[model samples]
Target: MRWFSSPLRDCASPRDPSVSRSRVFIYLGLAVTLLLLSYQLILDRGPGIGTSWTAIQGIIVAGDEDRFVPDYVQPAEKELVLAAMQASNMSWVEEHLSDWQVNIYRADAKHDDVGLTVPVNKGNEAMVYLTYIIDRYWSLPEVSVFLHGGRYQWHVDNPLYDSVISISHLNLDFVQEAGYVNLRCAWSVGCPRELEPARYLRERPDDKGHPTAVEYPDRFMELFPRAEVPEVVGTPCCSQFALSKTKIHEQSLEHYVRLQQWLMDTELDAGISGRILEYSWHMIFGKPAQYCLDQRECYCRTYGYCNMTDSDIQNQWVWRGLQLPEGWPEQSESAE
Candidate 1:
């Protein structure tokens, strides 16, 4: 019976050197195969992961220098107002008027409390005057509103134009007629109770050169879909990030060119540069939009436009749209 015992028992024993050596070799081969597979996976995924990481790093590094104080107004309040404005139907002024003029007379031109008086001619040949006093102390970026005398006779529904009047009616000339139309508003300070906390936090100025927000570009790139990313750094449109007003400073055109170069060099989105350039122009050079109706020519070499009027320069280039040259970078789907 011993002689007839199966050879399987002998083969399975730990003392069987051949069987033990074979099992060890098999395990080593599998471990080596897994290592190779993992290495390949990392190599294939490197660029995308690296780009996202870099983008996030850039944002974080940048934020360290430029902290963003959240807007004082509640996000809900802003959203509600914006939503109402968007949903409310308003007619666009299309007809050209012979005597189209917009003027902002300092309400207390006599006193220091400056207010704005704006009159617009509705299509029915009737004019509506809107008056509002601007209070600077309410917020660093003050909000303007309507005074007692503001009304629209021609149309029951007149879009509030404190923000728009300055830009839309730049061509209108100011008339100093007495008793024609009058609207007066008193000045007030302090944020609404609901918004006070947010306002207080925002009003505290950040230390210069410290980043208020941090964005990791690399993380963003990783999170972004692969189809949206470009393979090369300088492909048409690739980079997407926010720009700070301080970053541009006085070098408006140069700032734009640098942004464009960065987009191209980094193979981000080419269109983003143009968009950022437009925004910067608006922030730095655009007269309050309410003052300048026909802003198309405002960017003319002779007539740069800006928030405030300056006699020294004929034209201000604030908020000028980009005029890309021919052979602008071609669009690529790989970098959506």
Candidate 2:
């Protein structure tokens, strides 16, 4: 009798082994219920298991009108853009979409845009609103075209660029030719024509505290890296940019997940991380030729194309004598 002790025969209820067994089942059932509840919560909060989640090629229209520092605040004129999208019929664009959903954050208080829906007191900013899109969806379109709510100087009806009569028609050709095409603003937007990284990093590294921003000796390295801070940067200088699905497909969804998470969690303002990623988008794609033999072809492959060729190299004008870095293609004989 002593050798065959029951597994659930507690000293307090030795005679009622059945009761103890029943209690064990009760505890087990409670544990299972808690697990199910927790799992449901996860599904509600995130696109959890078996949730046919699809985040693919599409657009993200965001608006945060009143909430930014003066230097970085969004343009106030975005209400006009929203008025246009609502007035026109954009349902046709949905036909080409791989994913059925379109996320819109209206620039004005009058509508329910993503920017308006997101809780303001929480650490959400317009620059990082796109981060919320990636984090919450657990997926991103291969080619994500992000546009600020406001209008820019480059707005065009049509100029012999593409087949469609859309805003994208103005950009698709240029982006196809380059990895990422920012608004070609007045006198070049990113990396001032004269402020080369080589002379600037040692002489004036980014005011310190910017771990992810570094001047790359190899400009090619900035286009993409297995792991490292992006130093080779330039300025599109605003919230408007387009990413190619092919180049973006090179990395896993987890990479974007972590990136968005960091943008949300970090104390550093958009001035740092936002600006870091802003300049880094093209670099994230990849660079081609060390030197452009044919400037036009070299410039054309910069954006939409995945692989750069001998005809590679996006059209970027590097600075003069001051920026002669050690690793990058040496300054041209004439420039030196």
Candidate 3:
């Protein structure tokens, strides 16, 4: 039997197993101690080491001026309008917004009891909205809330899909501050990067089959003369939004006149023309070309629903018997 042993190990005095075990224990103890110290430092930083922890981020703890309710909002200065077809039922506006100064504009060339009717049914709610701005430019309210005629619609940013609930909780002060606010806060259909005009030709076609979307780049240039068309145009959809009077004044009266003229004169289909304007409204009112708001901030700022997590928003999106992407009704009773 040949036994092989290292001369170095034999020469070296037998190493104490207890000493080796103690060294190992010492190394592990140092590691655990360092880890615990690092964990304590992180804990001192708060709930999330780097991210926003709403609990730690104080709210309205400052003076009254720092509050959400600003003194600039006057109830009488707010103007609410509903864009309606001649046959659409507008009883809900009266029912829900009885306190508001509600105005209705008929799109079917038929005069309502209030004698507000668009000259033509050219662009869905776009025509009505532009008409109101042009007709009342000089006598505009401090804040105008433009809405579709229906009380309940999928586009309305509320759990109930109820316009009444949405409007009832609307933060007018936010509108006054923001200058332009889309009533629909949810960014499902339209959001972050909806249209890239420069890449229109090669981009995937719109599921809704909007022909004018292809022509949007040219139309954008035409709508804003001498101005470069933006690479991307986006906002929350469906034509319902709020504009501060000062915001509307940012554009010349003739600018709106030209937009209306284009709507009437353009050979594009009414729906297509309206859709183009729908995407353009944010830019028209001084928002950036890509105007998608953070959903959490939007809910908090626009409607006073604050401190919501991603999970909270998902829970709120309980669609009432409506299928997604295809189940959306092509035409709601008073849809834009």
Candidate with best TM-score: 3
Report lDDT (CA) for all predictions.
0.24, 0.39, 0.77
lDDT of 2 by residue, 1-336 (tens): 587756666545436678789999999999999999999988786653444333222323232243221111222211111112223344443444323234444322232442333322122233334343333333444334554332311321112211122343334445554544443321234433312444444455663553434433222243333544322344434435555544455656556544544455556554555555555444445642111123343233333233445323222332233323333234333554
Better of 2 and 3 by lDDT: 3
List runs of model 2 lying over 4 Å from the truth: 1-51, 54-102, 106-129, 132-142, 152-168, 171-179, 183-187, 191-201, 204-232, 287-336
Writing each residue's lDDT as its tens digit, candidate 3 over 149-266 gives 8776767777667788888888999998999999877777778777888777456456357576687877888787776777777788878898898899999877887888788788
Question: For candidate 2, what is the TM-score?
Answer: 0.41
Model 1, stretches more than 4 Å misplaced? Answer: 1-4, 7-14, 49-336
| Separate clash counts for every candidate | 64, 14, 0
Off by over 4 Å in 3: 1-75, 111-114, 201-210, 318-336
TM-score of candidate 1 against the unseen true structure: 0.19
**How many clashes would you count in candidate 2?**
14
lDDT of 2: 0.39
Report the error of model 3 at residue 289, Å. 0.9
The TM-score obtained by model 3 is: 0.70
lDDT for each residue of candidate 1 in 83-118, tens digit (9 for 90 to 100): 011122222211322122212332222322332211
